[model samples]
Target: MSTKLALLPYAAPARYSRDERLRITRLAGALRLALNIHPGNGLVMVLGHGGEKNNLEALETWVQRSLEAQALPPNRASLQPLLAQLETYLTHWEADK
Candidate 1:
């Protein structure tokens, strides 16, 4: 018998749901360690290739909302600025639409 590991597609989108919220938290934590971004220092924001602000905002909202709903503890000192950014993005999203 041979054991094998299949790498998930990098471009695959995360499915949003209650269960997935836990997954996202883990994903963020892994990213923090992998990118060397300590919560105390700063948060990492990865802009996708050819990504526009609108699309970015939408993605941000998806992640932020899940975090808030789950009351996920901040790995950093604070998450206020990140929350504020998402709020601002939503405001403009409605105005632009």
Candidate 2:
């Protein structure tokens, strides 16, 4: 028997200030570099098989540590969109399982 899965509703693209957009662009570049340099390592391993909850927790912890290391304020508004994207990805991944 075949099973049909319900599709998730579309989400509107997030709006960002110029500074926030720059930050997001830089972050994406960094992630691409890391993945290219160390395929199947570190964060990839954590997010790969750790399940959704653990993946989110690990991502949050990494974000916190990165902010601390950079001496940045604890304001996470700029990252909310990125987090939301990750959450949506995780939800879809779980459904596929």
Per-residue lDDT of model 1, residues 1-97, tens digit only: 3323221123434455765555555544543444344344212223222342443333443444445545554333224444454455444544544
lDDT of each: 0.41, 0.43
Candidates in order, TM-scores: namely 0.29, 0.31
Scored by TM-score, the top model is: 2
Choose the strongest candidate by lDDT.
2
lDDT by residue (2-97, candidate 2, tens digit) is: 334432232333454677545644554443343342333444333433332443343433443444444444344535544454455545655666
lDDT of 1 at 87: 50
